[model samples]
Target: MATNLFQRFKTDISGIELPEKFTFPFYYEPHILSKIAAQELQNYLQSQTDFEHNFGLEENQKGLIIGKMFGVLVCQNKEGELGYLWAFSGKLANVNHLPYFVPTIFDMLHEDGFFRKEEEILNSINRQIEFLENSDELRTKEIQLQATKIEAATDIQNQKNKIKRLKIERDEKRNSFTNLSLSENGTSNCELVKQTLEHELSEESKRESILLKKMTKYWNFQIMNAQKEVDLFLDKINSLKEERRQKSGTLQQKLFAEYSFLNLYGERKSIGEIFDNNPPAGAGECAAPKLLHYAFNHQFKPIAMAEFWWGQSPKSEIRKHKQFYPACKSKCEPILLSHMLKGLDMYANPFQENPAEGKEIEIVYEDEILLVVNKPAEFLSVPGKIITDSVYQRVKKLYPNATGPLIVHRLDMSTSGLLLIAKNEEAYKQLQSQFIRRTIKKRYVALLDGIINKNEGVIELPLRVDLDDRPRQLVCYEHGKFAQTRWEVIAVENNKTRVHFYPITGRTHQLRVHASHELGLHTPIIGDDLYGTKSNRLHLHAECLTFMHPISKEEITIQKAAEF
Candidate 1:
């Protein structure tokens, strides 16, 4: 029964009913059994002395702080006894085999494993490259090459200047000879003297040209020799780099092939096949897959599963401590949907359902040129992939003969806000220009999950989409758009703060991320499903909007209060 890996619950859970189907994995609230199991596992983590890991919870913790995602899978044995299995995503404390958590699907770090052998070779290649790159011989050659180029340039310029001076002197000599011949006036000796003078001048010009050519040739040879020496080292470095690249690719492919999973029907599929031979790094090593694989292999009837963050959030992504998060889409979707849970009865994906059903958009202001509508929370400003009922669709139906794109700006699906709409092409262009030029003013009111210490401040954070998890953003400095927000606290009550956000730059989920990210406010907005805990709704509303009238050239301002 593998009692060591699977443990019985400490508290009686007989009163709780089991989930009707397996967890959808991508999104779903944890079942009672799964929650209980997670709580129990967290307790063990607090008291366990099996390993040392700094989760950055202490004020002065040392070492590289790495937060982890831990998961629990509830299962029942053939004897009808219910229990749960525990697993952590990836490795903990540089080790794959821990005391209570399930073992990794494939132990690549084992001393005798093929992965280790190949990794050693790869490391050796890296060391060789580094040594050559920093070698005194390479540095000396590079410096000599640069110095040779400078010397050659200076020598060539001097030779050119010398030739110019020589040509001027020759011109002066010809002029003097011509004047002497003219002064002789019809003397045969004078004609002979002029011819001799011309011949001498020609010879002098030829000598100067030859000298310049010889000097140039000498400098070119010196520069070429220096370049060749440098290239010799570079060629070796490039060859080794190519070899390392090929070996790394081959090693990754072999590792992918080694990572295979099993489903309920005894069907086995390799990670390569699951992701079409191009999986992201660490695809099959997440906690959900490991727990499910272990449960299936051990004849445990899978019930429900939940994954939670066990420590401090990472610098780029928003992951609160002890918060339950959905399975990452980029890595887990292909593995779980395509192969692992083929025959299991799973919960219906909530993302597929329309959040805007039975909701309506309220028109706040209407004129001949443009209009404003208060979009409800959970309503889409534009048509989404699965849901077609949106503000754009509704507005289009109302104004069939209207020209250009009906909506000028957009709000997120979960954010309730005032959206500006244009009825004509000219109006749309003018309104859009106002927004682009930063003339349009906007204010959003939100309820934060925690109180902010500062009363008023500004936040500047660069943002980019989390490629692995769609709709989720990361604070990335490398490839991100600039996003800024100014906020002032309105009131603090019941451990939550209400604040007004004035975004200077519009970006997807800018305010939410700026509020939740550790570098920003470090307090997520209440009911923020992506960055914080989910509630009945995301407590953010676009309360005020001010822009110039597109046709009339008059300023217009509209305001609405949040329902939260």
Candidate 2:
């Protein structure tokens, strides 16, 4: 079959027009055909022995399945006949398996190919790295030795304390003899006691100093040498990993260059050009795109499509068994967007069009140096990359001469309520200072999606944006900023818990991440699309803002109630 084809008004093979609705490749509501396929797949999985039993039973079981993603793509033939194609993420599980699905766009597993050789070489490197890791047990033994040395040093100190006590008692006895030395015999006894005490004290001081020196000097060379060996081993492993990445990246680019992608319009784009930044690791390897590409090239009308996860979820992210997921942003977004059956109910691009249309910025309080307003949901607090209608623009219109950034603190676009705007440079500096010093107190009222066991607690999780996916943050200890939120449940409403949030240190998505992270509240805020499921609106609102007035130095408090 021809691998790639560009769009046309009508295929020479069929006179049918393309489907009217453009399918947004990434996020979509599954079609009826997809639902049926998913149900069948789920039924098949249930018959398998341990499909759902132990997957999420423990925290450690995540990402252990080595699972594969599967998809069912619906297609119509040139004669207007409809059928579905089944495909897997990378390759069929077994090489000898009977063919039940559409063949992959290209056999990624051709034994005589360059790809196979590169993969084999990469495997060899991985094996060496693993062997090195297993053989290096010196670090564990070094820790044990470190503890043993500390205990031995402690024992010597205890002995030194005992000797000091004994010396003190002898000195007291010698003093008593001195007071009673009127007789010659008493004087002789006093002299004997003093000599004994002086000899014992000198011996104890000498032993203590010698023991202390031994503690410092003993095993010093061996331990240092052992630590150096462990560090060198780790460094070698890191160096190999970098080399492996470079090798894999080169292979990825080569494969991407050879492959071409197809869209619903029947347009063609080379995978290499689709990903100008870097070709994703597994390009044209996904099930849905593979099926669609084959069908389109074979002159079949590509219809609806769906992909479902087949195994345990990763620890950091949540995924349900049999639940469908959108194409991955880092790996599959560009590919899918370039090659899905298009013209099927496309998603709107809020960035290109005005996202804040028909919205009004409500000013709560206005003064010569400040503006306080209720920021509407979906409205940016300041000018954003794509959406420019913001509270900053509104305030700028109201006070054209106002200097400094008028928008002080920003609320997430999905969040609604109180916002403070500084009108002048001096006022902005003073207010910003209060925020840096944490003198500014702000409260957010949120409704959690699930019941929260604790009534009140504090969450301190380091957070960083998932660079692989934009606008989403995760709890990453290695590279994250400190974020803290104190929460107290206010009320429970209709199987949901309403909570009060007092932020101590502000970071992007601070409250949202704290509420959803397992180490934190372990409950996502209601209607959090990024962390939780999508809903009508985000059930979070910045209800209050309190800070010392920049000029008056008086405490100011602002409050707004959340709507559901």
Candidate 3:
């Protein structure tokens, strides 16, 4: 008789002895096929590190006394994702005898619940489509609104232009009329002609009066019409601006909602503080260092916090006084906080009484158009109104006849190196054009953490500032602007590598970010706050710059030794 395929898969082992009698149909299966499937699943898991696990078979069964089972078959996969099999009492069947049963059973079970999976996938796709459509609609509406505002602004500007043109035309007409050799110390030229004609004098005088009245009326009409158009245009501008603000507000709400939904599971952050809470740092022009210190400490009075951080006050003086300690006789908490914070000069420094007189800075090169200088670290490249000892100030003093010495480029405050200066506006504009066109070349030397693999190669990576963390950057593949740099290893010591960098783009903190994050070298220039590994000093130096001279039309190259 042909046995049931599933019956061969089962074995009975209630004890050391097989069961004497069986009540249920004993249909057991080995996990040989399931183990094979698990192996494939392991390969799939290997592709995704965040979703990881181990999969292996761990079981052995002994058989069967004369048509009776003594051992059992067992298999298990972690996570309880798969746990379905049968146990029975009988002679143990070899896996070869029942190949079709396990596959058929697993397939049947999978099909039983497959529709739910398909429905879930379809739902996810629908949600994404809906979100995309909404976003497009909002964007289109915003663009249309902006276009309307721009049209209104343009109309107002055109009206003003028309008014100016009308004024000019009227003035010219009036000047020509008054200077027509008709209104002078002598009688009017028309009057003199009329006098000679005698009988025609009365007729000519009447015609002249009529002509003057007509000209005056025409000029007044034109002026009034131009002024009316100007007023109408200004009114339209104001109305359109109000409409733009409303549309902008709508767009902001939609965008903020979308952002919140997508980032629900991400790090939580807030744009504005709660009513009574103060932001750790305020936004825009009122970034008070003292208030920021207070917020960082997280100790706040509701009224004081609201006023200082949000530029708002409590409803009444009583609430203000109760919640926040009053400042003498004033009811405003922000005013009190600002005064209290400003009074503490913990971070402020006093002017030196008889400070050391700065030495005259060295001028590497100078001419009629430009000057090149070896700038010392910690010295300002260009002088501020308050600065007395900057390289730019010194150069201006040395060439007293020169005017408006412009800084063409600059090195960082902690970086000491060579720089070029334009002496006049023409040279400044020429040099600026060269920089904008990427015709100038800048190179630097840096000591890195470890020796890079290639003795000499290139690192093609993009960089941008991390505005949130203040003076840091991350690998932003999606939104970052493009930046490129070429690096070559100069020398390899026991562990550290000396590398030379030539930046094709002059982005802020480009070289430091590329070396540390892209190359995984973690190399930073000495004294740099964002990229340096230690606080002692950074290990980078601006060693060279090469460009064409704006006036002399000669190739110029400036070089400096690494500062340490």
Best by TM-score: 1
Using TM-score, rank the candidates from best to worst.
Answer: 1, 2, 3
- Among all windows of 10 consecutive residues in model 2, the one with the lowest summed lDDT is 2-11
Question: What C-alpha lDDT does candidate 1 achieve relative to the native structure?
Answer: 0.91
**Per-candidate local distance difference test:** 0.91, 0.72, 0.45
lDDT of 3 by residue, 236-313 (tens): 545555555665555434333321100112222222221122322322112121222222222221111111011111
How do the predictions measure up, each by TM-score?
Answer: 0.87, 0.67, 0.39
| Superposed Cα RMSD, model 3 | 25.8
**lDDT tens digits, residues 26-62, model 2?**
6566666665655665565557542333334355653
> Could you tell which candidate, 1 or 2, scores higher by lDDT?
1
lDDT of 1 by residue, 1-564 (tens): 377888889979978999999999988889999999999999998888899899887668788999999999999876778999999998998899898888888999999999999999999999999999999999999999999999889988997898899889989988887887678777888777778888988898888889889988998999899999999999999999999999999998898788899889877899988888888988888999999898878888899999999988898999989999989999988989998888999988877888888888899999988899999999989998888889999999999989999899999988998999999999999999999999999999999998899999999999999998998999999999999999999999999999999999999999999999999999999889899998989999999999999767888899988999
Question: What's the ranking of the predictions by lDDT, best on top?
Answer: 1, 2, 3
Give the TM-score (vs. native) of candidate 1.
Answer: 0.87
After superposition, which runs of candidate 2 have C-alpha atoms over 4 Å from their true positions? 1-20, 27-36, 48-74, 77-107, 118-253, 264-268, 283-288, 306-312, 318-324, 338-347
Q: Which is the winner by lDDT between candidate 2 and candidate 3?
A: 2
Best by lDDT: 1
At residue 19, what lDDT does model 2 achieve?
44
